[model samples]
Every structure is written in structure tokens, then in C-alpha cells.
Target: MSQFVLHDELWWVSEFSCESCGTRLCEHAGPGAAPDDVRQALLAAHGSVTLRPTGPAPGLVPVLRALREASGVSLPQARELAAELVRDGLAGTPAEMGLLRDALHRRGVPADVQS
Candidate 1:
């Protein structure tokens, strides 16, 4: 059996790995759809995830903090990610966004994940 893993990092980076064959690929893009091959591999491996605010807008400060904590990014990068979260929403592998969702929730920013 083949085992695959999908990791969604800050800056819209997606890393795909297949344990069976030691194959790894990384895709980096702006705020848009993931590359077709990466998307397909992610869907096949861990499925898709959409993370959106469930309650009112959580304000930028808390969101930025959460983004930084979850992604280990610098303040500026986290700010950019927070902006994207508000503007375009967040999509990634379940575990990646799940961790962010949980982090935001802990900071009193309610969010939901659609898979």
C-alpha cells in the first residue's frame, strides 16, 4: 500500500510526499487554486479542507497572532496570511488547516473546517 501526506504551509505552499516511494513534491503559488497535480494528490491522500470564520470577523490582531503561532511565520508574513484568510479564505490539507482552526478558536476566533 502507498501512503501519502499533504502539508500546507504558509505562503500557499503545499508539500506532497509518498512514503511508499520516497517521492516528495512542493508547490508554491499565490492566492489561487493549487496546481492540478498537487490538488489531485492531496485529494487522493488526505482530502481537501476549507477553513472559514464561523462567527463574526475576529479582527486582525487575534487572527494575525493565531496565524503566526500556527504557521511559525514572521509578523509580516502572518499579516499577509491573515489578509488572505479574510479575503479569499483558507484551503489546505485537513491537518494543516485543522491546527490553524484550533489555534484560532483558542484565541476566541471561531472557525469552521469543511472537508
Candidate 2:
């Protein structure tokens, strides 16, 4: 088995693969999986919700706390949401952040730290 690490600004995805069987442990999905559907299913199953943290230090702590209080979402779900926000640029701009926060609130999230 061969192992590899894939890192981004906010994620560290670990992958394992067997060169012989071509089996791998990764989030690296094929094109047919459709990122949107994969994301949505992940969100629903994990109870993940993304939000922009308040103030200059945008962080995932507050967003995770809020979701925990609001829906008792698991840490993994919160983690997935945090990852998505970081990837989707939801935390990059006011409008985009607002959209993400609003979507979370609609899904029963209690707090939105987004400005």
C-alpha cells in the first residue's frame, strides 16, 4: 500500500492506494460522481453546515458551535461544512458568505457569524 497526503488551505486529505489493484482511499471522486450531488449527500448525512465566523479572525469554531447547539450535528458533519466553505469561497466575500449562512440557517442552524 502506498500513502499520500493531499493538502489545501483548510484540509488535509489522506489517501491510501495499492498499485496493483488500483484501489485507493481518497475523496478523489470520478467525474461521474458529480461534485454537487456528492457534496449535498455529504452535507445531509453529516449534518454539515458552513458559515463565516464573526470579526477579522474568520474561523470554524463558532460555526461548529452554533450547529452543535442548533442541530446536534456531529463533528464530522461540521468539519465537512467547514471544508466546503473554505473550498467554495463562502468565506471570501460578504455576499457569498451571506448565502452560505442563510442556507445553513434555513437548514436549522442557529447562529451565523458571517458579517
Candidate 3:
């Protein structure tokens, strides 16, 4: 199972359990993307949502900062993400997209989440 958790910052956890043996193990993540397998599972099960920037171009600086604060991506990664936002926006789980939408809003960038 994979779950999203909110703490001082956002986090994610995945767990495995054995029904017969009653054994369990879990993994936790910091404030950023979940593991690739976990994310893939979620997308396969629930589909993906996209965030689209609306109105005039918001510029690269605000988008870079939004990606940095919301996803904790490195500066170079943020730059790439910013480009994607201007080009086609970004896609992820609803929660992930919402996090970015709000971050962009806070930076005065107009954007919306699309299901």
C-alpha cells in the first residue's frame, strides 16, 4: 500500500505485509516525489492529472521557485520543470498537481489543475 502523509512537510509511505506470516515492512519518503514504482502504480490505478498555466506567461523565475518549494527539485530540475509548465504544464497525481498549483498561485502565477 502507498499513502500520502502530511507532516511538517509532505511525505509518502509504502508498506508490504504478509497475510500468513503477519510480517510487515514499510518505507518512508521526504517532501518530494514518491518512488517511481509507487507513482506508476498510482497512475495505473487512478490515472494522472495535469497542471496548466493560464493567462499571460508567468515567467521562469516564479515557476522555478514554485517547483523548488513544492517538489524540492534541484535548481536544474526546476528549470526543466519550468519549461514544461510553459510548454505543456506538468502531470502527476491530483495531490501532486494541487501542491504545484498552490505553489504557483503563491508566486502569483496563474495555473489550474486538470483531471
Candidate 4:
């Protein structure tokens, strides 16, 4: 399994094969995050990343909206994420944090990714 952000989109691809039986399967998704299990495995292997706001704090509305769009989460989820950011930053895999960071920057909300 491999997942990363490319061309401003998340690319998730998984390949499964059996050497003896000569059977193979592949599942790939476009423009979105990987399944939770895959993401968790990556996070466990590479450690976690944190995205925190930097510079001056921005308005709540823009922050929430940026987070919502970046993560493709609902408004309430965005609020929770925003709260998490305010508390200890948003924590996730590198791809996720980086994508969120880009989104925040695009929305004029300064942020930094900590690995």
C-alpha cells in the first residue's frame, strides 16, 4: 500500500498478490484519503505529523472552512479539528497534515507541519 499527496490530491493505491497461486488484486482510490487502517499503518510506521497554526491567529470562520474543505469533513468535524488545532495542533499522517497545511495556507491561515 502507498498513499501520498500528488498534484494537490491524495492518491491511495494498494496492491495485493500471491506468489504461489498467481493471484493478484489491486484497489486504488482517487482524490481522497486512504482507508483508516491503511492510514493508521502508515502513521505507525512513519510516526505521526502535526499541523499547527503559526504567525497571527486567523478568524474562526475561515479556519473552520479551510479545515473542512481540506479534510472533507462536516462543519462539526471541522470545529472539533479546529479545537484540536488550538489545543495541541492537528495530528495525523504526513500526507494528511501536509494537505491540511496547504489548505490553511491557501485560505490565508498560516500553518506549519511538524514531523
- Best candidate, TM-score: 4
lDDT of each: 0.71, 0.43, 0.79, 0.84
Better of 3 and 4 by lDDT: 4
Tell me the TM-score of each prediction against the true structure.
0.61, 0.29, 0.78, 0.86
**lDDT per residue, candidate 2, 1-115, as tens digits?**
1111122111122346889999977865322222455445444544443354333323457656544443345998867766665555233222223444544564454435333
lDDT of 3 by residue, 1-115 (tens): 4445364245666677889999988765455577789888778877899999887645778878888988888999999888888789899876688778888898999999888
Q: Report the number of clashing residue pairs per model.
A: 0, 0, 0, 0
TM-score attained by model 2:
0.29
Instruction: Predict model 1's lDDT versus the native.
Output: 0.71
- Name the TM-score of candidate 3: 0.78
> By TM-score, highest first, what's the ranking?
4, 3, 1, 2
Task: State the displacement of the C-alpha of residue 27, model 3, in Å, after optimal TM-score superposition.
Answer: 4.0
Measured on C-alpha atoms, candidate 4 has an lDDT of 0.84
lDDT of residue 1 for candidate 4: 74
Give the residue spans of candidate 1 off by over 4 A. Answer: 1-43
Q: Write candidate 4's Cα lDDT for 11-110 as tens digits.
A: 7777789999999988776667788888877777789989988876568998998888777899999999999998899888888888888988888899
Error of 1 at 107 (Å): 0.4
Error of 1 at 66 (Å): 0.7
lDDT of 1 by residue, 1-115 (tens): 1122234332345656889999988645443334567656766877777888887855778898888877678999998887777777798767568778887997899888886
